[model samples]
Target chain A: MITLAVDCMGGDHGPDVTLAACRQFLNHHPEARLLLVGRPERLQGFAHERAEVVPASEVVGMDEPVEAALRRKKDSSMRVAILQVKEGRAQAAVSAGNTGALMAIARYLLKTLDGIDRPAIATQIPNMRGGATTVLDLGANVDCTAEHLLQFAIMGSALVSVLNDDPQPRVGLLNVGEEAIKGSEEIKRAGELLRAAAARGDICFHGNVEGNDIFKGAADIVVCDGFVGNVALKTIEGLASMIGGFLKEEFSRNLLTRAAAVVSYPVLAALKRRMDHRRYNGAALLGLRGLVFKSHGSADALAFEQALNRAYDAARNNLLERVRTRVAHAAVLPAAPDMASVPGATPPSPH
Target chain B: MITLAVDCMGGDHGPDVTLAACRQFLNHHPEARLLLVGRPERLQGFAHERAEVVPASEVVGMDEPVEAALRRKKDSSMRVAILQVKEGRAQAAVSAGNTGALMAIARYLLKTLDGIDRPAIATQIPNMRGGATTVLDLGANVDCTAEHLLQFAIMGSALVSVLNDDPQPRVGLLNVGEEAIKGSEEIKRAGELLRAAAARGDICFHGNVEGNDIFKGAADIVVCDGFVGNVALKTIEGLASMIGGFLKEEFSRNLLTRAAAVVSYPVLAALKRRMDHRRYNGAALLGLRGLVFKSHGSADALAFEQALNRAYDAARNNLLERVRTRVAHAAVLPAAPDMASVPGATPPSPH
Candidate 1:
């Protein structure tokens, strides 16, 4: 049976939403087993044939500092869950707790894979082709170098290849414009490295793509520094929310519009279903030795279940092994020429 | 009567769309006159009492390098149009041409205003509150320092104060997170500068805002480096387009859905009208000695006319003088203590 570790006390709703989601997730995946990590008092009575409770003494607050959480909360649910992966008790770990603490603990415990400098958060976003595009570095490693971007591209391409079942996924470098000369020096240098990597047949680099290309299905996998990717992702969420508000306001404008809304209920419902972000929950923290998935902090039962399913799929597909092999191959490629010596090349620093 | 210079040979559609827009614009604004600058052969037979054709020998190709367009194409229509503004023959200049060429020429001719180090491209975006937020540095200067962001805030606030008629427009510095410690060092330093500027009554600083805040109506003016701003703006455009394509596909799914679409036509029409980007076509290039507005390259006649209307409004409202006054006032604020000595400060380089 495939086992997964759950941070039962994480997220805004805590054990209530998580426990309910675990129940639903267990029902759907007959071969799946779960280790629920949280305070014993808070997780009382959660008994099941396929599930076991791992006792923990503390919970990571959503707004807690990474240092405090890492140093003070030794027995926190988030760290305990990640320990399951480290100890081989579970194939993967999932959390919706404080992102900073989660990354810190994951990096400290599981450690990064050989040849990988840092891990990236990869998630799926809906695209125009009725399929989803996998984007990486969602919010980890805010400032990244060309080398980091090259690593992200290799990792993202591997993820998409397995998830989408495409052997040679198209990898796109996100920039201000499609032209090679359009973005900052870091992006331009990253583009050069990606091009070289493409030459070695590591990935099918589709050249530079603008932000809009993420949703336009211009490429199967889009790679960017965490800052740009995070901003782009949140901007999409905000715009979608604003559009939803606009639709509601217009549909209730008058009696005639109200009747039209009734007639269009089915169509609108389908659109909402297609655009629902819950279906795409769970961002994989790739480049680490073990698999870890992060769900949105505000995720409800249904959304949490989706994240569980995503983790299960990654484990079953041998995603970690795929990343390991791809990264190993990437290490063999000749290092890209030093960009620092190139005029105007601004080497990125960590945030 | 207010006079506007028109780069009649700019953009993808060229003089055909621009001249037609001028005809319609003149009909709406009886007090407005147009000076059409382009090749005289291409401008033959245009005989409107309020419109006059200024002969020009060359046109800047959309793909031409900015250097070539600036130095080689000295007598180009785009340059001639800006010359009208510089020579005091026109109150404003409008172009639908290449953005890079236009900005380079405008900056070269008009120069930046006193106390302003760089000009910013500011445009309006629809928000959930049924109003628009002004976002600046769309694609002008990619890498921006804290000082540059502070300047953008002051200039954006001044523009909004005049256009929105609000004495104190909330100015937000766009970042990855709302927390003070969330983004890169440059963003944090920029936040400090913004707070100090706010203390001096230079702007109504709303503190750090995330990408979603741009559409959440969280602030009246959103200030960001051009790289982030451009990416965010284009991402919005792309998502909107993808959603539009999705609606069309769903509404035409089958016979039943098609019939429902007809019944819901009015509601959909209202939604489309509210979301139409054409209504917000013009982007003001602020901080220049003379006023200049840029329309989208693919703008149709109606959209071009909207840009013309925007230019007229800015000229009437004295946007240039307002920016000048605010910038001058900003010059006296004690220069933010040099942050270079601060640990973890990444000094931003001009891109």
Candidate 2:
């Protein structure tokens, strides 16, 4: 059975959202089991043959600082959930809690894989090809070197390979332009490194791609530093919400327009389902020795269940072993040159 | 009367688009005159009392390398057009040519303003508030210092004040999150500098804004390094196109969907017109001694006309003088220590 640890007392809704998602998840995956870790009293109502309640004393706040959550809240639900993965009791762990604290605790307990300096956050954004494109370093390292970028490309390749069953995924280095001479020095150098790795058969690099290329589906995997990736992700969310609002206003302009909206309801619903980001909720914290997936903090039952599904799939597919194999083959990720000195390069909390 | 120099032989469509735009622009604004710079033969067919064709010996290819275009194309139309601004023959210059070449020639001829280290590209993106958010460093300085960001905010404030008539336009530093300690060291330092400037009554700082804030209209002016800014701009373009394509597909899915589309045509058309990026085509090259505007290379007649209109408005309102006044009042722009030493920090080409 593919068993996963759940941080039940996490995210904005805490036990309310988590418990509902766990019950639904249990009904769908017959071969999957869960170790629900949270305050015993909070999870007592959630009883299933495939699920068991594990006790924890504290809960990490949505706005808690990473240092405080890691150093002070040693027995927090977030930490105990990851401990299940470290102890080999569960194949993977899932959380909807604070991202920075989760990454710090996961790194501290499980440690990073060999040849990987820092773990990166990877998520998929829906693209025009009726498929989703995986983007990495979503909000991890703020300032990354070329080597760090190269490592992200390799790790991302493994994630996509296991998730999509595509052995060789095309990796694109995110840049201002596609030209060889474009972007910051680190990006250009990363392009060169990616090309070299591609030559060695460690990856399938598609050269440089612009932000629009992410939605254009020009590459299967697009890698960027955390700051740019976060901005791009947020920009997409902002634009999508604005468009949704505009569509709603247009549909209810008057009695005549309201009739037209009723007629077009089927088409609109199909379009909405195709572009729904909730279907793509899970984000992998790759490069760590153990597999961990993060759900959006404000996710509802459906979205939280999607995260659980992704973690279950990653574990069953042996995603950790795939990443290790890719890293061992690349042999290019040199320990980031004193990661401590890179100002603001520490693991950052996600908004 | 305002006279603006035009690079008539620029962009992908060259004279076909630029000449048509100039005609419509002249008819709309009798107070505006154009000094069309290109091969005289290409512009000879057009005749207007307010427009005159100036001869040029060369043209800059859209995909030409920056160095080749800057060094080899001396008498290029792009150069002759800027020469009009430098020689005091026109109040401003407009081009839909290679961005890197345009920036190189504009900076080389006009020079940066006092206390300004580099010139930035500022453009407007339509927001939900029935207004547009002005974003800067679109594709000028790829690698920016904290001081460069501060200067961008000051210059962007000037652009908005003259164009939007908002004397104290709120400036937001683009980052991963809204919190003060959320981004890179340079971004953190830029936030401090902006806050200090706000304390001095030089600018109205809005703390930190994420990428979505540009579409949300959270701030009047959003400042970011060129790399991130360029990506945000392209990301919007890509996603908008994808949505447009999807709408077209859905409306033609079947006879029933087609009938619904016909009934809903008016509402859809209004939404399309509102979100049309062409209405916001003109991007001002800020921080230069002279006013220069850039149009999208692929812009058709209507979009090109909007760019010309923006340039006329900027020139009539004395955009250059406004920027100069703001910089003088701030007294915070320190000369960059060594721009040459920063790798890939040179002026970059826009896609």
Q: Pick the candidate with the highest TM-score.
A: 2
Q: What DockQ values do the models have? A: 0.46, 0.76
Residue pairs in steric clash, candidate 2? Answer: none
> Model 1: per-residue lDDT, tens digit, B1-351?
889999999988998899899999999999989998999988877889999998889999877877799899999999999999999999999999888888888988999887777788999999878789899888787767888889899999888998899988999988777777767777888899999888988889998887888888899999998888888898899999988888898899988789888988888888998898899889999989999999998999999999999999899899999988898887674343433223222111111
Cα shift from native, residue B252, model 2 (Å): 1.1
Q: CA lDDT, every prediction?
A: 0.86, 0.91
lDDT per residue (tens digit) for residues A87-115 in model 2: 99999999999888898889889998999
Clashes of 1: 0
Scanning candidate 2 chain A in windows of ten residues, the lowest lDDT window is A332-341
lDDT of 2 at A116: 89
lDDT of 1 at A99: 79
Clashing residue pairs in candidate 1 are: none
lDDT of 2 by residue, B1-351 (tens): 999999999889999999999999999998999999999999999999999998998999998887788899899999999999999999999999989889988988899899898899999999999899999999899888999999999999999998789899999999987779888998999999999999999999999999889988999999999999998899988888888888889889999999999999988987898899899998999999998999999989899899899999999999999999999999756656647446576566554
